[model samples]
Target: MSREYKNVISQIFKYLAISLVFMVFGFFVGQRFIPQEYIYYANRIIAILGVLFVLLAIFSRKRIIPSRFSMNYVYLFTFIDGILMYPLFQYYLYDLGIGLFVSIVLGTAVLFGVLSMVSSRKSGGYYLGLGNILFAGLVGLLVLGLINIFFGGARFNLVISAISLLIFTGYILYDISLIKYSVENRFIKDKNDLSIHVLNLYLDFINILLNLLNIASYLDD
Candidate 1:
């Protein structure tokens, strides 16, 4: 890998590690410290704050807000992501047991590692052109998800989970490929850009894990 490519990857992973720490901390606090009576309310508040921060970061990117704080907004949004995921993870861990949970987590990690490696190759740009296609798949998944919420079935959920797994896994490749492309083309101009890359990876990892868990759960049912 070129030095710049390596540096960009290193910075992205460094920020990813920090985000994971906050994720774990948030999960721990949600599971162990928050009172049962307040858990619902806490999640609501966290979700709202997550949306607000995301908008703030977007606006900052558009120059509506000072760009200097955009990276901070990204980090803060990631911390909220963890907390927002707490209740869902708790439900799965409790309903399906730790064995399934651990297996899904390991599966996600392995898949992420493999895809990242593939995207780090010199020819990674092959995946770079997939951004628009993968995004369309993602949008389709969201529409299917909402439709299922009203006309839901275990089988429907399984199908969505299966499709979503493929899409998000594809995203891992695309995001990593973009990282390599960005470095080679000098597109990553600043720390804020780096933080956005990290956020994309973070979301990809989280979604993969969630979809894997959903698939396993549906299959078991």
Candidate 2:
């Protein structure tokens, strides 16, 4: 591999590793230290902060903030994301029981690993062109999710979960393709670019896992 490609790859992996650590720390803090009474309040506060961080990252990408500070945005968001994961994780952990929860998690991990490998291949570029389609799917999924929230049907919720699972599964390939393309073309000129790539992959993985958990929970029920 070219030196540029190698450097970008290394940085991406480093940032992802650190993001995972931050998330794990947040998860542990939420699960073990935060009291039940405050969980609701904490989630609300953290969620607002998360939106602010996301906007900051978007602004940085758009050159509103210095690109060098993008790493901070990515780290902060990931840490907050871990806290977000806690409630969902806890719900599934209890609702699905330990065995099913573990099974779904393992399944998601395996799927993520396989998709990453596929995205690393020569044909990875094919997925790079799928951003628009995948994004449209996500938007549709959100609409359906909001509708399901109001209408409230088990089958409808399951359908939303399944669709989300597919959309995010596509996102995994799309995002990895983006990383590869940007790295190879030297489009990753600053920390903002790097952070965006890492965050995309991280979000893709998290969504896929959550969707899998949701689907599995519905099936188990």
Candidate 3:
């Protein structure tokens, strides 16, 4: 990799590590520092903000996030998303204890590492071509997730989470491939591009991590 490309990748890894720390810190805040009801609402608030931040970051070129905005907010939303995920992780921890949490994190780390390495290679075009299929699967998963929210069936949730895990695994591979392609083609022109791409990888990582934790926790419960 070129030095610039290597620097970009290193920045991505650095941001991801920092984001994970924020998540763990959020967990501590939720479990100890804050009241349960407050943390409950805080999670919702952060989730909404997370979406808005992502959208704003995407549309920054149009003056939504603004050119003057710092990259800190991009990372902040990542931290917020981590906070938003705290409850789900806590629930799983309750279900399966600390061991499962550790295993899930380890497994996700390994999977992400392998996928990122492979996807960063010059031969990563195959994952890039799956854009349409991946979108279709995500939409289907969204519909199924909504249905489960209303119906509350164990079977439906299991299936949904399983499918979600697969989708996010695909996402990780595809997203990393996109990063490699964008960097090589000189498509990542500004901080906006960097922030958005990092956010994409962060989303892929968290989805797989959360879903893996959920699935294993359910089985263990």
Candidate 4:
């Protein structure tokens, strides 16, 4: 592997490891320590803060803030994202049961590992057309999800979960492959570029994990 590739790989793994820690913390807080009302309200606040951090990262990159603020934006968003994983996993643990939750986590980890390895072996990003198709599917999935929230049935949700699972799996492959291409092609402008890459991979993994868990829970029901 090239030095830059190794650097990015290390950064990705580092954040991933931090992700596990926050998820465990979230699980613990939700299961044991947090009271019902606080659990309800805290998530709302955290959700808003998460959005702000994302915006901060966006604006920082656009140079709305000083150049020195760049890494801070990335760091804050990354940390917040890790904390966000906790509440998410906690909710899943409660709804899905510990056994199923463990199964899904293991399954997601294996799937992500395989995808990352496969992506690393490739030379360039897949065609832009694939990304367009995947994104279109994602937008459709969101519309369906919003509709399902109101008017859909169990079967509809199951279908949505299945489709989301597949979409994110494709996303994982696309993202990892893109990471390789960008690095090899000298597209990484700075550390912030790697930060954004890690965030993308992190989101992809989390989405796939939740989608699989949702599918599993529906099947169990």
Best by lDDT: 1
Residue 199 of model 2: what lDDT? 73
What is the lDDT of every predicted structure here? 0.69, 0.68, 0.64, 0.64
Please tell me which predicted candidate would have the highest TM-score against the true structure. 1
Error of 2 at 79 (Å): 1.5
Per-residue lDDT of model 3, residues 91-185, tens digit only:
66666779877888899999999988877765535478877777777666656655555564555666766787787788778877777777778
What's the residue-level lDDT of 65 in candidate 1? 51
Off by over 4 Å in 3: 33-70, 124-126
- Report per-prediction Cα RMSD to one decimal: 4.6, 4.5, 4.5, 5.1
Query: Taking the tens digit of each residue's C-alpha lDDT, what string does model 4 give over 1-221?
Result: 57788787777678666655665555554456444444444324333433343344334334564433244454455555545545555555677889988888899999999988877777677533467777777667766766665566667766876887787788777777777788789887676666666656666676677668667756777
Candidate 1, superposed: residue stretches over 4 Å from native:
32-69
Clashing pairs in 3: none
Q: What's the TM-score of each model vs. the native?
A: 0.81, 0.79, 0.80, 0.74
Judged by lDDT relative to the true structure, which candidate is superior, 1 or 3? 1
**Model 1, residue 2: displacement in angstroms?**
0.7
How does candidate 4 score on lDDT?
0.64
Question: Which candidate model has the greater TM-score, 1 or 3?
Answer: 1
The C-alpha local distance difference test score for the whole of candidate 2 amounts to 0.68
